[model samples]
Target: MFDVNARIGHWPYRPVGTVDDLLKNMDALGISCACVSSLDAIHFLNPQDGNDSLARAIAPHRDRLVPLAVVRPEFAGWQDDLTRCLESHGMRGVVLYPNYHLYDLDDPEATELGARCSEAQIPVFVQVGLEDARRQFGRTIVPDVSLESVGAFGREHPSLKLVALGLKFGQPDQLRQPLPKNFYFDTSNYERLGDLEFAVSHFGVDRILFGTCAPLFHPRANADKLRCADLTAEQREAIGQGNARALFGL
Candidate 1:
């Protein structure tokens, strides 16, 4: 399986272990590859440090890990950094931490950045948050990108292949609501029984991607969720890695 969302580096809220730990966990869970980003970049003073570390860490493990560069939309020369990540490091995508970076999807710079990514044919991963409000640390009350903004952004940039990680809708009707036609949801947080069937039935398997959200959430458990879902072979294949291969050009 190719995990659509995963991370490496030290997180302040919890222990993330090492790159080897991540790889070992993936191996145990039968996860063949993961598109990983650096947590260090989420709130770092020098964002390049995180990107540099990620490139270095994944150098020897390119077969099992694909780097996802993190960029601050408001920063000058971020475009150059993204270019280096693509042209030099061969990263498949970029991740945006809006709450941690203190930017909104409606920001003009963010819109321009999205346009650039769309033109480049690179996928963009938007993290809603590391954890839910109840699980967050006391002093750190990080906010999430509003679903309305996500839907709006998707509508504005039809070409942008948006992937929303940690996106959960409480009601079934919300599942059918208008979203970016090209948008996909990572299945890291989707674990309720019959949820996969319902989502697949409603949204089609093409819009769902396998994601473990490893370390933060157990890869094995998430893997089990899909493995146990009553889905057709084609649906399983699509959610497992087929959609990711096509969407990411892997």
Candidate 2:
């Protein structure tokens, strides 16, 4: 699951023991591969430091997990830092924390960062919402990362792929028609308020990927949702694993 919302200190997280521990857990959950980020970054301080912690934790077992670097694109020299990350760490996908970073998604820096990521062929993971924020104790005035900004960036660069991590229902239909060929979405948080049937029907199974936000949420819930749904075997497979493989070129 390439979800952007998982954290290190969440109540439901299973402590990661080793790379083997993570892999074995994924196997037990029927997940072959995932792009993981640090929970500390999503909940604690700056995302870059959290990313560093995650990198240190998973560096040895990179074979099992694909690290999606969490970055605040607004910070100075972030592009250089990102280039170094892609070069040294072999990171392919980047997760943006627009809410925690406290910047408008339409900011010029964010726009440039998207283009830079596009040039690097690195996909972006953005969150539409993280439902547990207020319940977990945090400040107010958190600016949401508007989909319109992501759409504007996508429109500007047709080749860049953008994935919305936790989109909710009635969240506006930007992806309704003439859908951006480059933008994709996940089915992790679809348990409530998501149009799963419509996504499969309109976006096609290939365009939607499966993500369970593991530890924070059980993979079984999502897997069961896909299983019980009225879809063809091929469609289910695409949503469960095939789309992920294609997205990551795995």
Candidate 3:
């Protein structure tokens, strides 16, 4: 399973730790593989620094792990960073954190950036929340990415496979709406497992994948939650390993 969300952070501003520690836990929990990034890079500097950190860590362990390039279009020369990620890091996709990066989806630059990602045949993942920071760290906070805006962006960029992570406070009615065919979501910040089943039943299993914003949250709990759900074996496989495999061409 390629975990679309995981981080390498050990600085004062960072919350998580090394990638090896994550791999150890992944091994113990029976996760074969993941595509990881650095939360520090995402929250701190522009994408190149974060992408460099992730690229270095995953280089030796390419068989078990993959690198997803992090890019901040809000910064200068982001296009070069985007090019390097595809040409150098061998990134299958890139993820964004508009809330953490303090950018708006409605901006012309952000819209073009999404278009650039689509042209590169790279999927884009965005973090809707980061580990419920109020409970995890101190009194830090980040704004929620309105699902409404994301839906509109997906509609605008019809060819891009846009993914939303850490989706919280999702009502069942939201799942029933006709989302873009290219739009998908991951499972994290979940209050109940039944909603995932409802999402799959309404949107089809291909649109959902298993994910855990790990090190901040327990990977075992994340894996177990999907396993224990009231889903068929086919649905379970799709979320567990199949969809990510298909998404990243693993």
For residues 129-225, could you state the per-residue lDDT of candidate 2 as single tens digits? 6555545445454544677876676777777788887665534265446668888777777664336677777667777877766656665677677
Candidate 1 lDDT by residue in tens digits, 1-250: 9998888888887777688988999888889999999978987976767998889988999988989999998887898898888999888898988888888888998999899989999888888656888888889788767767776777778998998887765422343475457888888876576978988988778889998887688788779989999999999999999999999776
- The full ranking of all candidates by lDDT, starting with the best, is 1, 3, 2
- Where model 1 places Cα greater than 4 Å from the true spot, the runs are 169-176
Comparing 2 and 3 on lDDT, the stronger one: 3
Best by TM-score: 1
Clashing pairs in 3: none
Write out the backbone clash pairs for model 1.
none
Distance from true location, Cα of 171 in model 3, Å: 5.3
lDDT of each: 0.84, 0.68, 0.77
The clash numbers for all candidates, in the given order, read 0, 2, 0
lDDT of 1 at 132: 81
Model 3 worst lDDT run, 10 consecutive residues: 168-177
Pairs clashing in candidate 2? 7-39, 8-39
Better of 1 and 2 by lDDT: 1
